[model samples]
Target chain A: MTALARALITLAVPVLLVLLAVLAVPADGPTCLGIGLRIWALFACAPATSAWLWWRQRAVPA
Target chain B: MIAAFVAVMALSLLIALWARRGAGQGPRAFFVAGGQLGAILFFFLSVGETYSIATMLGFPGGVYAGGEGFVVWFFGYILLAAPVLAVLGPWIWRAGNLYGAVTIPDFFAAHFNSRLLERVIALGAIALLVPIGTMQFAGIRLVLGALAPGLPMPLLLAGAGLVVMAYVALAGLRAAAFVAVLKDALMLGAILLVGALALLHWPIATTPVATATMAAQVPVTLPFALSTIAVQALGFAMIPQNWAFLFAARGPQAIVRAQAAAPLYMVMFPLLMAVAVFARRMGLPVDKPDFVFLAAAQHLLPGWALGVVMAAVVLAGMVILSSVCLAIAPLLTRNVLPGLDGRAQQRWAQGVTALFIALSAAGAMAQVPLLAMLNTVFYFGIVQTLPGFLAALWTGRVRAGGVLAGMAVAALAIIGVRLAGISAGGINPGLIGLILNSVVLTLVTLMFPRRDGHSVMAMLR
Candidate 1:
């Protein structure tokens, strides 16, 4: 439920932005979700690379 | 005008002296205020740390110069930083408290049991942090130059420099914490006063000049906004000094609470942007673009209020930065020096702090590109630490060999990325470095796991 809420909240901004732009770009309406997806990609991003590097350090038990 | 600044300096120094008396015991008090700071003190100091002279001065100037792109960077910070702090801060606080760690290297040494690696991390932190300190000093000179134009720049710099150095050397973080109270009070008063005056002087429309300038500069498209948020968010979590605040929190719960509360800082960004928009509309000629706060304060405020604002911005930079450098230097000296007694160790640490300050000040004078590049360059080191430090505390199985190796790879990759200059397009290389670092650590740990020190981990949990 939290994830659903988060996703909905995140999409709301881009959706509004695209909707506002749609009156001008009638043919571009289909591409709005693609735009939303990219924005969502940005939102979902974290500093995961370091977590990956840290996780690589598992010591072999003696 | 000079007399006013002199008066402020004298008062700041006296306040610093009085405050220094309360700090109990030795290095811990000097470095971390013995971890006894209250919430109000913490809130103000943390905010003062955030609202550096750069943010106070350069941020408005950035909006004046580049329109809304920088505003995106500014606002995204709260989003990026709060969560990272919430999750990581508590763990670090617990570990730091448990080990009685005074510096980042102390914690590193305790976790890895390798003094050599600890010293290396210490040196990396000092090397990166110096430029940040230098910028603060440079900012002092700029404010003084504008406020008291008749006084020589060198004399003004020297006066401000001596006050900062004395307070930091005498009272350490306790002095900084107390001084930050005055600093934040002046800062809040100045920001609000200037903001109100600018609004009155040139009342902006609902969609201000910044929006118009940015709209003219770049189309209000999805790619622009997405990329803007992406770069800012990534860079926000990777700002080395800001990220290091996690280690200083009272505990995990304190960190978590601080993170949850930090979003309040974000709400003010748009307000600051509005002030800049008003300033720009009123035809403020800002060539350097880092002089907006001082310019606005001088032009818009009464003489007494202007003096207060100038002192606040300068001291905010000087005090916080000096404490940071002072705290960082001992971490290196203690780990690197061999067979020194406690007194000798203290003397050496003080010397290192002084030297670090001198070198960084010189770099500022020289205008070295390396120092200028420091804002982003240091994030590489911090990203490397993320994996080793977090894993060691969270799960007992992470081996030193694998942790160190993963760090090495991440460091190399970040350096390579930096050399390519791809990260300089405002995207954070540290974020990419972090991802690589975590992945390597995870894979290598799973392949070759350690079971020793499992009991220590259990105790913490």
Candidate 2:
């Protein structure tokens, strides 16, 4: 993918995760459950971010 | 337990000194660790700022004392800000590298070619950092007091401050980064262990497991949560120490790789919440709300493990305090006192680091009302520099005069809002100040665009 394409994916990744979070995690759930879901969501978002960054690193090599 | 705590503290100092063995010489070497930190050191250092004593104790304590709502903004800010850093951090590295900048003031002054603006940022940064350095001591007092109830709080804090000063004096940023690797490992282990224990021994709950994250009586209102997250997430990008850490990176890619992993580190938060709930469930005597995490861990862990946990907490505070001292040292010697050569700068750095520690310790000991208020506004005030920094990085259209004027109006706006005693319904006042600052800055720049014909973006490219 092009750099612009990768940038767009990086931008889009958060929105998609938010959408999935809304579907998977209940906002008004139990505190522990809510915390768990958020962590789960974070797990989802964080690794995805790393993958995106790793891909972007190739285009702009060190 | 006492032996364990002492050993951990010694290890932290040893790692810091170890970082300086065979290290390059001169002010830059000391300040930015010779600007050759690989991805691992940069990752540890950058993430170090996120998991401070505040996270270890304050996160759980806030939840145990207040409600789970406390985690919303705290976790939100950390989780959301990673991407922002991942995007902006490399760019910040680019800016810092373009001008060989060690401090934010150094970057601003070099980019704008304005000594007066440098002074403004340097003074503002020092004022902003005052509360932050002291807050670490506040945590130190709380953690050490819990561990060794026999030890005097004042003496413990003073000693912790001295040790942090020693770290700065020893290797500057490299010392902080090297020690950060140990602090992070121990902190993460402690949190995960205590949290897991809390889960394994989950008590029958009087209340439901699904306690609401945003309770009606909770102080962390929805507007406040959303607004604080937004403002702080952006402001997190603008923090001075983070900049210093990023500048230590070998290049922009190191920043990219390091910050990319920062968000994943927040995996510790859920466990933090678990530990908080554990404290509440067992009806632990949380006389001081901030001690809830330590109280729970003390209840769960055996002597040696407790020692390791306490050491982690203390070292968490020390690493951050050392980073703040590092940030301030350069501001004082390099930007604030620009005439010092390498030898003179290092000499002044030691004295300045010691003086800063002394003053911060004095203020923390006194608990002056004004210092407390400054703590409240530090984040808001710190971000006021963001506009000017962005202008310097992305365009030459911005003038030092414009940046200065915007920051002045923003500071006054925040002061006014505070004096009026308005919460804006839990919204952060600094966000308001930042908006007004941006508008004023835009108008001033438009009305009087620069004729210097220098393009910062072009130069960087």
Model 1, C-alpha of B236: deviation from truth (Å): 7.1
Lowest lDDT 10-mer window, candidate 1 chain B?
B212-221
Per DockQ, the best of the predicted structures is: 2
Against the true structure, what is every candidate's RMSD? 8.2, 3.4
lDDT of 2 at B98: 81
lDDT of 2 by residue, B174-200 (tens): 999899999999998998889888888
Counted clashes in each candidate structure? 32, 2
Q: Interface Cα RMSD per model, in Å?
A: 12.7, 3.0
Model 1 alpha-carbon drift over 4 Å, by segment: A1-62, B203-250, B369-372, B422-426, B455-457
Cα lDDT for residue B367, candidate 2: 60
